[model samples]
Target: MAFVTIRDVAQKAGVSITAVSQILHGKGRFSNETKELVRRTVDELGYVPDSRAQGIRLAESKTVGLLVPDIRNPFFADLVSSMEKMLYEKGYSTLIGTSAEDVERQDAFITTLLGQRIDGAIVVPEGAESPGIRSIIDRDLPLVFVDRTVEGLDTVPSVVSDPYPGIESAVETLSQLGHRRVGFVSHSSLESVSVNEREVAFRAIAGRVLGEDGVAVVDCDNTFRSRKDALMELLSEGVSAILFAYSPDAIAIIGLLHDRNMDPGTDISVVSFDDIDAFRLMTPRVAIISQQTADMGRQGVEMLLSRIGAKRRRRAEHRRIPTVFVQRGSVGVAPPERRM
Candidate 1:
């Protein structure tokens, strides 16, 4: 089939080609009603904007890029969905890349997005630092970090949850339940924003309550089998309860416990960092520190748009979304001997 062009849309809308271009590009002054009319006409005509032509006109591909460490995880899935929805509403297409928790893959994805001349990007980095990220910043591409942040890159905007307090609360709850030997299960090293912040908070709180030797830290590869093995190891070390840095790890540990004929709440307490939908439906609902997934997405898009509209660099912005702890059945009192 022949490619539908701007002229086709203009003819259908009974407007000049310039008007159609302005409406489609979201440039210059155009009435909202007229914009809607042109959009409808374009849809009716099955018009697909020529991205090459768009690049020639605006020096941008009119595309936004998103990179996530793991798309299969529910938290990342929800985040990506929200971002895509918001960008779609603003008349921008999104290109998504899954880095699979690998720094090399993340770098490749960044290069590909930059090659495509994406207007902006939202990245959840697989590593704590990357030259690819630096390259984007050097080129002054509008960029935001979602869910994670790096240490040395101070100029980039970031949207993250304040994970320290929630970790502290979880540790305190476990300590109060008479759990002296408490353990933590984290996805990766204490370098990425979420994992590092939570681990720091957990260590501080656990040190204050249970002393240095009382805390056990286990690093897993953010996979079910790896997390299950880590949990089993912790359990063997007489850990009465475990704090999971994310929901996927918590769910995996719970499943492992069930496989061993142990009840989650009664046999071992669990606290998860992020709350997903399925957590509420479980027989023993999981306790969680919930991040505002939708809010993060909306805010990231708004920030990027603001930067794009300004057409100049503003002071670097770092916004932290608050987290809330929800008590559920997964937390219970420790056994008599394990009690503090």
Candidate 2:
């Protein structure tokens, strides 16, 4: 089939090619009637803009690249969808890359995206030492970090969820419900600023609500066996209630509880971060510290767009979306026997 061109649309609509181009790009002023006519003609002719040709002419691909650590994580999936929708509305397409929580893979994806000549990038970097992040910094390409920021990368803007609000609420609620001691299961194996922030926030809040001696902490790797061991450790610490900073560990713990014929709420109260579907759909709905993924996505896109449209690179800024605690069946009254 012959590819329909803008020239064909211009001829059919009785307008100059520039008129069609301006209308399609939402650029130069055009009468409503003229714009409608051009759009109708373009639709009838099935004329799709040649992004490559346009990029060569305008020096912009009109595309944005997004990198996430794990797309399988419902939070990232929702974030990607939200960002893609907003970018599309702004006349830009999104190229998505998943790193699978690997530093080398993260750099590789960044390199590949750079090759695409994306106008800007929003990355959830694995860490600050990534050469890929440095390349973007050296080239001065518009870049925004989402979910977490790199250590000492003061020049790059970031949007992350504020854990204090949700952590404070979760600890207070548990304390009020007779949870004298609470354990925090942290994903310490991963070098993530946000994860560390969550851990610190929990310790502070738990200490304030239940006393410093009430706080129990354990590090867990991203593995079923490790999470199981962490849960056992927290139980041995005599924690009546427990919070998992990572959602995967919470899911694994729920299964492990079932294997031991223990109930999540009755035998031990449970709470975790991220309001993903898996948590909501569990037998006893798991309590969540929702990071507001939609808000994070919107903020990231807005920040990246501002950088991309600016005449000169502006001073980097950081934005935080406050997380909220969601009460669920998983957070039942702390067992009297388990209470300190």
Q: Please list the C-alpha lDDT of all candidates, in the order they appear.
A: 0.80, 0.87
Error of 2 at 262 (Å): 1.5
Off by over 4 Å in 2: 1-57
Q: Provide TM-scores for the models.
A: 0.78, 0.83
Candidate 1 to native Cα RMSD, angstroms: 11.6
lDDT of 1 by residue, 232-276 (tens): 789878888888886777887788889888786788888887778
* Pairs that collide, model 1: none
* Model 2: per-residue Cα lDDT over 62-170, one tens digit each: 9899999999988889999999999999999999999998988998787677656678999988965687787777767899999988999989999999999999999
For model 1, give the 10-residue run with minimal summed lDDT.
51-60
Candidate 2 lDDT at 332 equals: 84
Compared to the true structure, candidate 1 yields what TM-score? 0.78
